[model samples]
Target chain A: MLPVATGEFDLIRRYFTGLGGDGDGIDLAVGDDCALLSIPADRQLAVTTDTLVESVHFPANCDPALLARRALRVNLSDLAAMGARPLGFQLALTLPSVDVSWLAAFSLGLAQDASTFQCPLVGGDTTKGPLTLSITLMGTVERNHALRRDGAADGDYLYVTGTPGDAGGGLAIMTSGGERHNQYLLERYWLPTPRLAAGELLAGFASAAIDVSDGLVQDAGHLCHHSGLGCTLVWDQLPLSTPLVDEFGVEQATRWALSAGDDYELCFSVPPGRAAEMELAMAGAGEQVTRIGVMGRGISGVSCVSSDGQPFRLEQAGYAHF
Target chain B: MLPVATGEFDLIRRYFTGLGGDGDGIDLAVGDDCALLSIPADRQLAVTTDTLVESVHFPANCDPALLARRALRVNLSDLAAMGARPLGFQLALTLPSVDVSWLAAFSLGLAQDASTFQCPLVGGDTTKGPLTLSITLMGTVERNHALRRDGAADGDYLYVTGTPGDAGGGLAIMTSGGERHNQYLLERYWLPTPRLAAGELLAGFASAAIDVSDGLVQDAGHLCHHSGLGCTLVWDQLPLSTPLVDEFGVEQATRWALSAGDDYELCFSVPPGRAAEMELAMAGAGEQVTRIGVMGRGISGVSCVSSDGQPFRLEQAGYAHF
Candidate 1:
């Protein structure tokens, strides 16, 4: 296998040249000094980046393909926040050694996600180091219409797309003895479906938006805090996966749904009247849009109510970056 | 010292929160789910990223301040290739532990460059890992006016900015015996100056351009090879630093100037008619511009000629990424 440090040209040809080249908004792709992107006349570009490190953000021996997809997906989930369409992304990869099989699998995973998501690989750098991957994603949204977290207001309804807590349940199972490689849970933990369509559909309708990366409650707190508003969550309304309920029970599943990271679901707030419109949009996209809570004015924080309408609190707030 | 995974929020707040918030085209800054940037109405953004790892890219005990500066400067050099104006950058740092004092000094050096170059720190991710730093920079250029290596033509004059091989000289000094830590050489290796002003000046004037990160001869080879031309270098005209000449002698200094990397200077081609104009541009920017070679159609590689016009060739070409 060719090492990236041997020559950048060889590395580019081997891993990126043939992949992610056939996509829109990519004026110039990899193997160039810098990638050239053409933003559509009426669209604005949105960019987000995330870095995942071995034994820190993920396990050292984690599935290479799945890890690649997850890293890109997390950045895509950020695009979902701005209601942007994924255009392309650049990756910076650092590895301790030149392991061909691992690189093949990892590149396959990245290529698969890029194709599936219609995001081209534009440019990147590969270097020698402790295993690390940084992906910078670019997306497009209507000019001046990108979603912002400071748009939430009192009386807005909070909604989350898709089921949550499956990832948390998967983590529990993976860490324990049930199954080290349950396809469904592992897929949930690794290959997340970034709620792009739902976010695009919610662009003008949603008041404040954020992806459920850190967790439902934690991300909700972000929206509220950024918008300078408080939010009330109806725990009974949170969408929990069947596997989560079966494994952890409804109460524990709800708690997990509130605190688990890596969900990649969109948690957004819409005005009360637009709730029905959001449902219609979801129906058109063949996706679920579950209402979870309501936004309110006051000190910026999150409050949760159980099935019986009592206040609920969690021991862990969210995953924080230092 | 707090390990990054343990001091998440505080680290982000201290290192990233408001660092690049006041940049020219930044729509939104850090402390959000994702950064928002506005590509100027008449310009396109040039994006590039690079990652450095401890013990691989640099020694584990490398000076923190210098390491931080190079982490961003190298990426800026990529922007320089595209003839883009430095706007801002994002950093993703993964460290085993957070030494507050070290981070402070590192940030101080970063701020010095940021302030000097008018580029701001817009966003970044901080995590725990074996020490690694990835920087993604965004710059702006007038639509369709960016310099590219693909635009070079036969008979174009090749030019390079400033002295070459100081960084390589510093690296050699570090690896070789007998030479104590020379502050000048060491600083060159560590705190590289990105040729932003020079690049902007070359935007409309140069036929093709690239920044010398992988030595002049090798990188110029890229410009020539990509442009389907061969290049002839006048070796005696090659620029060198006083320290490099004093330390390595003329022949070795010439070799280092030809083949060493990490200079972060611009190398470009200009039509004969535009040579005087290009010189004025370089002069206006207060950067050294030296004519080193000429591009021609032939073997499609680089060759150096001595003052007497004899062929000059090295056993090896330049830095290979691998």
Candidate 2:
């Protein structure tokens, strides 16, 4: 699927080949049949893959650079959830046609994020097809230090980093073709930061962890199901960005926070006894986390309750790919 | 783009989750945020990515099992070209819709090949789109033993494993839909064997190596371009299958052998002094290799000559993606 077209190499060489510079743990980079990567012996490789379809995942026509950033960042969020430090990534990008300017912006965006996360673009594959991006990002984690869904225990404190569901709201705004007054929401939609530092900090400490991609409540279900526990999320404590709340109002924001996806924020659980200490550690590291729920065995599945012990329900579970 | 639709998990859990099995170098396999893998510190990872789009790479409708095999084998071919041992692979499949029986067959095909190659399914991302499969396969190779295009010397024997161009002939047969009588060519097209063992045997021996996927002439040009040498391909020395020769005749067979792609065979070069020794080594391994040409600095690019010393020419270079 490579030896990609005539100018495909030019596109990659001109825009992408320079992404992974010297001393990035890459023994050999592009132009070879395979990229030879040097992973530290003591560290285990953490591999996560994500594929974004043009019409299904994002707007058909948007900033290509932002799309590139979002694609890489969301995958980084997975590495973050596993408490793996960024290493390098392979991008298999399919396009319907070659657009030089679009590729320029896309590669630029990838370059920026690769630099920001210290994850260089080690290798890539390009083909002609409907615009699709499949990125396989690898990271390094200390042996047995990966935060997993099964690590959670009953009665652990569930914490979420940053606001959840703002990106979903941003998507809503973009889809409606509405006035783009809320730059914060748009940026959140375009750039959902991967909590890499927080993930590294929480590696051995957190009981269980996951990124809020397919909504907070649904992904929380995964943690609960895998851990054989149930969770109770307090509606009032849900972290909603001010812009999202102001634009979509509290009820919608509450639903978005609970049901809408594409947040990319970390939703992790820690032992209640260590909750205060973990919070302190995160704060010291310049990260913000809100304790919005508690893991328990009382509930069968995920439950949402308001201040008065009132039950809250979601219309749909989360984003689904069929 | 996971957290798939209602039946998506059912599809994955039923057909895919059981692929890697219990022990295959996967610390953590599917269903996790990231797959935890153990790569020996001394060995570098040989990573390659490939994407096959529907109607572009293969027929719109075909046996899902063969398609799956082709998808994985071509990528494995890249690993074999680098003389790397297969470790694991991640498949990102984007489909227009979920088909149950299709997935069952596809997963079965993948299971057979993954088990045969010793490359387990580490992780995967499934989404909805115009049927596209992007696979990122990783292998482990000794730090400095990887055979590269640039490793060739000015004077070396250009050797190829197995017969090339049969798969291209197979593709031609498939597209015309004239007759399916030639099962050999069809199998060659569907299952281009990845010469993994030969690659391992050639690791430190061969000066340069590349899998013949994008036509022998073009790929050989890559070897010449990178190694700063030209090549003289002896036309009469090329190995051709009896079935291919009978079906397409000698002229077409010669053209196909010279310029058609999708052969998945290894085209490698070794110093002339060691060519016989390397040939004996390959013979010991029960693999066949033919010295079809010689690499040299005599010409600026690739030149082909027949037995009578007449120069040969082609109508087209090879397949182009765009």
Which candidate comes out best when scored by DockQ?
2
Q: What local distance difference test score does each model get?
A: 0.81, 0.87
Chain A (candidate 2) TM-score to true chain A: 0.96
Residue-by-residue lDDT tens digits, candidate 1, A119-160: 978888888877899998888888777888899889999899
Per-candidate iRMS values, in order, are 5.7, 4.6
- Report lDDT (Cα) of residue A69, candidate 2: 95
| Model 2 interface CAPRI class | medium
Error of 1 at A307 (Å): 3.6
Superposed model 2: Cα runs more than 4 Å off:
A1-5, B1-5
User: Per-residue error at B290 for model 2, in Å?
Assistant: 0.7
Q: In angstroms, how far off is A22's CA in candidate 2?
A: 3.3
- lDDT (0-100) at residue B5 of candidate 2? 29
Docking class of 1: acceptable
DockQ of each: 0.44, 0.55
Worst 10 residues of 1 chain A by lDDT: A1-10
Report lDDT (Cα) of residue A161, candidate 1: 90
**On residues B97-120, what C-alpha lDDT tens digit does candidate 2 reach at each position?**
888888889999999988888888
